[model samples]
Target: METSAYLNAVVEQTNTLAGWVHGRDATAPVPTCPKWTLADLVDHVGATQRMVAMLVGERMTEPDSAYARYVPAPGDPAQWRDWLTGTAAEAEQAFASVTDDTPVWDPSGAAAGVPFWSRRLFGEACVHRADAAAALGLPYELAPELAVAAIEDWLDTLTSRGYWENRPDFADAMRGSGQTLHFHATDASGEWLARREPDRVVLERTHTKADITVRGPAADLLLVLSRRRPLSATPTLELHGDRTLIDRWIEHMDWVTGD
Candidate 1:
């Protein structure tokens, strides 16, 4: 996806997140996040926007003290929507000041520039927006293209060695002797094949045989892949192969749970 597309999706998802919590209880527990209240989630979204804004707008090549010491606002539902929207607008303006190729600090160093930040922030907001919705007991929906982009970005992260640098044991657990998993989006023309290699997990955009294949709407697939929902509980997806392989992937994939 282009940088602009990602930025636009961030705006839309941020708005949706704000709407979910508008006039609602800030203290509401987010079942998906497990540890955060509604207000914590909102503050997280705003802080992330600010962090990326500072990174891209200032064109910093490294983390600054400000990024490290910043804190989230208190849980105040009456004001959280406005605060969240304001921060998103701040991020949008900051992103607008630079080209996609503009240099910026990336902790992983696997990807750099505004494009990376754009995609990163988009994923952060998109996944957390779903968390907010699930918390509020409201139905969630995302455009197929947006969901596809989210899935692709996540797969890209999995394929990056930098992501697993701190968790070598988990990385070793993920590697296998040519085991493969397929993800097929029934609502859109998106498909992916992920194969476990001794050194890393390789992902390709294609349709083929696999040890396990998850077929579903793009949004549902995003939720399951991101660990927001359990594959066994989600009725939208169809399992066509080794269920244990998918379960193992979910057991090791801990992006959302902070494990």
Candidate 2:
């Protein structure tokens, strides 16, 4: 998808989530996030969006206190909503002005640039939108291309600098096997293969059957791979060679990079 389209999707989803928060009972708990109320969910996502916007806009190399300057206090419904909508607008505008290839530091160590933030923000907003929707028993939907790209970005981050420090166990598990796990999106013609190596997990776009084959809609597959949704939700997934390998892969995988 074009950079603007990705930004549009992020903005649309963020607005949808903001609308949900505005309409929801402030005291209600979020089902997917368990410990959070609707207000808290809004706060978390809004805070993250603000953080990313600062990181990219300021070319930040370290965490900044500016991102936390507007954090909402508990039970502050009006402030929470304001933060969500306000920060989302700031992020949307920051993302809209950049070209895909403009360089920036992504702690995830994926491809650096406006495209990285574009894809990351879109995926983050969309997934949290799903979280909010699930909390309200509403249906969730995502663009197929956006879903596929999100999965790719996440996997790249997980196997690179991002995962190494936070999830050593997972990183160790993925090493030296030379084995591969393939994800095929039945609806979008999207395919990804992750190959295990002594040094790092090497990911690429491919279609050949590997040790396991996860099959689903692009969005569903992305959610499952991201651990936002359970694997049982995707019965369409075909386990080719070793189901245990796939199970272990998911169990040990860590998505966030950089401690």
Candidate 3:
């Protein structure tokens, strides 16, 4: 997808999420994220969006110190929502002004340019939008292409340097099997196959099934793979081959790549 489209989707999803947060039914629990209430989920997502916007827009070298200055303290829900909406608007404007090829640091050493943040922010906002919706017992929807790309990004990010270093257990489990895991999106014809090797986890787009198969709508599959929503939560998912392998894969999956 084009960078403009992705950025636009981020803005749209953020706006939708804000509305959900302000709804009367906002007290509901987010089943996807067990420990957080709808309000807490909104605050968390808002804080994350603001932090990422700062990291990419200002080109900060150390994120913790810089991000801490802008983040809302715990229990400050109103302030947090205000910051989220304001920062999301700022991020939208900043991204809208740039071209896809504009130079940007690849904090993860994976890819460079504005497109990376465009895509990352898009997926981040989209998935959390689903989280907010699921929390409010509302329907979740995403652009087909965006959903597919989110899944791809999730897989790629999990195997990247940041995830491996932080989640050693996950990395070990991922490396335990020489077997591969395949994700097939039935609606959009999107596919991803990942193989574990000694040196690195290799991934590619292919139709062939691996040792396990995760088949469902692109959006549901994306949520399931992201661990934002459980597979059993959705009726449409079809798990072929070993269920335990799929569980292991999900247990080890990482959402974000960089520290």
lDDT winner: 1
Q: Model 1 off-target regions past 4 Å?
A: none
How high is each candidate's TM-score? 0.93, 0.85, 0.85
- The digit string of per-residue lDDT tens for model 1 on 70-89 reads 66865667777787888788
In terms of lDDT, the poorest run of 10 residues in model 3 is 72-81
* C-alpha lDDT of candidate 1 relative to the true structure: 0.83
Q: Give the TM-score of candidate 1.
A: 0.93
Q: Report the number of clashing residue pairs per model.
A: 0, 3, 0
Tell me the tens digit of each residue's lDDT in model 2 across 60-92: 555555555655533656555556777878887
Cα lDDT tens digits for candidate 3, 36-137: 676667666666666666666765555675557676524544444455567677777777666666555655555555776777777788878888777677
Better of 1 and 3 by lDDT: 1
TM value for model 2: 0.85
